[model samples]
Target chain A: MSPGPARGPRALTRLRSEGSSPEAIDQLLREQRVPLVEGPICTFLWRGDADGVAVDHRMPEIPIPLPLRRLKGTDLWYASVELPRGARIQYRILVRRGESTESMNDPLNPRVVGEPIGSQSVLEADGYLTPDWAYPDPTVVSGELVDLRLPSRALRRDAQVTLYIPSRMRRDRRMPLLVVHDGGDFLQYSSMATVLDNLMYRRLMADCVVAFTHPGDRLREYGASAAHSRFLTGELVPHIEGSLRLRGDPRGRVLMGASFGGVAALSAAVRAPGFYGALLLESPSLRFTEATPSGTFGDVFEPVVRFVNSVRAHPKKVTDRIFLTYGAFEPLAVPDRAMAEVLERMCDELRVMEALDGHNWINWRDRLLDGLGWLFPGEARLIYPG
Target chain B: MRQVTLLGPLDGVDLAAEIAAFGVDGPVALVTAGWEEGERNDAEVDRRLGGGSRNLNLYGRRLDILESDPGYADAERLLRTQIDELRELYLLRLRHALAGLEVIRRRFAEAQRRPGSELDAAIDAVRMLDETHTSSIAAAYEHFYAQNPPHERPAITRHREEVAAIVAGCAAIAIAGGHVGVLNDCLHLGHLAALIEERPLLAWSSGCVAVSERIVVIDDDDPAGRPDEIYDIGIGVARGMVALPAATSRLHAHDPDRLAVLARRCAPSVCVLLDPGDRLELRSGRLADLTSVGVVAEDGQVLRGAQAA
Candidate 1:
């Protein structure tokens, strides 16, 4: 049976409140081929058949030029249209059936509500709070501990390290090591030690020690500082090996960190693949040049990018493992995720790539846990439900 | 296992339990703000817990050492000395126990590197040591706690007093129990509840607002003036009233319009209990039932739940 008359214009009005602009609204109506009604208040409607049967009330009307719609299959309809190009307009949607206000759970649209009804959801399109997954799990084991201290000749600061020995020692008794930047914060905030202990107990990934190096003075010590990288390669690794009694195989070491630390870790790992074996980076701060005072972005991030490109362009003698993660929440990390995608493509060409979720700490921690489980599965216990 | 219910100020006991649950073993070291009985409680917990018998120790340090005070110098000196002694004991014990294992670890590594050594045998030996160490530490703590129970166990009388304090703090009336008891208590009062809806009370800043329909915890930091980021109101007794404890503060001005709208929507039934300090109870939801101890109203008139309805 044929459904009721179309209500395309009304749908447009609803879509406007959902962040859709008039132009986008018009485009959607045209694409849907919905009929438009003109009167004291203009109304538009559309009717469509799914498998020879007409879908009833799949129509919408626009009270004004508002880009609104009552979407089928969802409890709430949404529109993504432009708003005066950079104009931040605040809007809300009210459902009404001949003056009787409809509840948030309108019998029509079926959108998922993370919150309760009668509340309007805010849209953040500029991506400040956009969710992105970034940061990989730094694998550290309880018994297999390694400590490294690197002093940068360039920056003149002491870099600290606390590495975890992996349960899976190589047949040659040599194990891979991961040198992680932002050691103190990573260990505490990210619960690195706990992750290591749990992963080691479970026996998920290969046993590896992560030499967690603290950022000297987070803001100052991270970018435009080749000294940190120098300290890592020159001073830290040797000190960790001598002090912690760690294995000295080049194939058994990786460089890892998040955000600015991720950039440093990647740069150091790329420069010294002879010493470090892998690069585990999350949400690298690539906007080093965008900051005013010093355009160090070119000197630091560009070089690292160029180095990665060069390495991919010309196959190096020593093969390295590269793992990348970024959060969906961070707008700054979007470029980094893009860069990771590029690296993933390169790794795909080389047939070796590991990428993980980057939404937030929730997603990051889960990814780290899962990745560590896969990388260093020691002895399987019942998987703990998060 | 002996249930050692500790009474008095909660210092780092919760944190210690959480960390120990992560697999750290031996006697759980707790640095407290001290018990009501003062320094004597330290020795009491230690002796009772078999600090002398099973090699398990319960070391309690006075929080005064960390707190700012004019006599801080003497406290600092004493704390440093005790800490040094504890460190020495811990390292000495750890060294003695793990000395043989260290030798085995080195030898195993060497064997794996050797041309004709059995890789599986060396790996198995290292694995065995790792498992033993992790399990033994966790087990030792369990054994220690089992033997010695804390002196000041929480009594039924104290529990009732706490519950009463929670109930009396309510602005709205109604005695709720079961899973909702703790939640209602916390909502009316400010203390963190232990249970809500059969689950442990998981109310944070936002969760507290989710407990009430009349009030929503607006993110003062939210750039968008939209109130969509709200959860369901909890099943607490004060579900219809917005209890703004410490109402005169600057923090109350974040969304005054929203607050006004909420109060107006509730109308003559609206009740605002400004907590100056003390309990406000509502037994039958009537204005006469709302016995205010130290509460005062500013904008809206104070009415009991029944009168407002």
Candidate 2:
């Protein structure tokens, strides 16, 4: 039966009449439904055969089990939490059914993003609106994509890189270059090629070449590895510059990536000063240390944490324009905010934006238009007429 | 040497003072093609140039050719009618595309279900429509020029020689602003692109639009309130920039989205803001480092000439 208008403070009477427990009725009301934005709190409700329910989110400091309580008179379970606007996060519900406990995606949420481990339901907080131009415009000419593999002496492996060339450029012309990390995922999942095409056709940026470099060993290479940094600066950059008609000046080059790739992009910039004009870091994995009750450093992720800490300590080493973004709902918010603070002092131009989406390709995809446009606007073209 | 010295406006910025900075000694040539009816009224500009400026009067000179030649005026009138009709039809299509874009943007932002693929389709439709319109405009422009090559006609050819003679003696050429459309049409008619070679040129306001690679018309708060459209291709003397004169008054500076769109629309080259006191040296068709002035940054901030440093 369809949910009728509420009669009083207690709602969902139809679900209750159907022999559904309070928890089940609550789940029915809350499940899959967009959370109503009431000031600072988003109230979430869930109902099922489980005796108990809890939300497990990606935030590092938040407790693992944020238990949902059932109403005293009804079988419905409810929970409320304060969230900043534009916080996009992935979350799972931990349900206790009879003798077993299980974690699963929200059956009510239609939006989801795939992860290396598994898919998670997306939660977009009220605040950020995706720009209209972020969507692909088919009317504009699309860039040509060619796949090529290069042997990397630094990493001792073959690296696959996809090249995107704007159609407007002549064969003899040398264009600026944008190098994207975690290239395969960005191309396949982020719809980056479409973004580049629209941005170029609109003349929001210069007609340039883009190199999407796929990693051989993502987990290791993306986490503050010197070898990976060397491969990018030594082997890949030189190869692309020599083979393609790309701008030789470093001021025309930009490096972009998300998550571990964000860290990797920054690491490369730190390693090779004056190599890139700008760096676009989306939800960069900037955290490296864990503090105990005693207020001392505890367990750490070795190289990744060490690299992040060193960069934070010496922010002036990388002077290019830094474009940083993070999701307010994710645990990475703490570290990303801290990094933004440090970057503000060092870089001449630094823009930090917080989105209402999670740490996924979708979030990164939304940032490409703004990030790339700010990083590389060609010589000058007219956009407004008086 | 191919040199271009761009200024904000001639209203306050003295042409003689500017020419003095260039350190050129000979008489300065003036291109008043953009002034339309007043193209011949160069007494003030001449005085400002220390009485050594010779007005090319491209606007009146083109009319002189058409009026003097038998049947040329009739042919030109017919072509004008055809172009006007085409422009009207293109503007109609532009309205629809802009309306469609507004709808898609609203729906994409408000819909609980992210309108991902559908939003893309709508955006593409608008782009396609714009592209189709622009291509048609370009084709029509080309056809008009083909049917009437000024070099083949006697009256027009004779006027071109006179223009060339005036340009030969001048050390620099100065272009003043007026209505951009009128300015661009007159410039094309006189073929200043061929005549202004090697000599340093000083241009302000609509003159910038006349020489830019493309002409984009934007009035954020127009009575009709339409999205900015690419009107036509320019002479491309100023290769990378899209010049917006009287920017502070005409543009909606406080609106980031509006500013961002404007900044993006003219990428690569800076979205040049021709405000008062702004002087830029554009060399080899690209803006030079030290003399490059005022640009609209992607962050919706206007970086004036001083900030260019």
lDDT of 2 by residue, B1-309 (tens): 678877776556677887887777899888776665667787887888778798888877766776687466666655654554465466656667656655775676677565567655655665566567667777877787788777798888888888889999999888887767667766777788887777888888778777887777665444223356676777778877877776666666456545654565456657777766677777787877424456778655767645754
Worst 10 residues of 1 chain B by lDDT: B53-62
For candidate 2, the per-residue lDDT at A254 reads 81
Q: Which ten residues in a row have the lowest lDDT in candidate 2 chain A?
A: A1-10
lDDT of 1 by residue, B1-309 (tens): 111111111122232332233232334222111111122334533343234212101111112212223243233333333433343334334333334444554575577653223433433443344344334433543443354221222232233345444433321111111112123222322212221222112111122222444332222222111121111233342333444433334134534323433343334343344333323323222222344322223233444344433
Ten contiguous residues with the weakest lDDT in model 2 chain B: B218-227
Error of 1 at A312 (Å): 6.9
Best by lDDT: 2
Stretches off by above 4 angstroms in model 1 are A1-155, A163-175, A217-225, A286-318, A328-360, A374-386, B1-309
**Cand 2, B chain, TM:** 0.85
TM-score of chain A of each: 0.51, 0.81
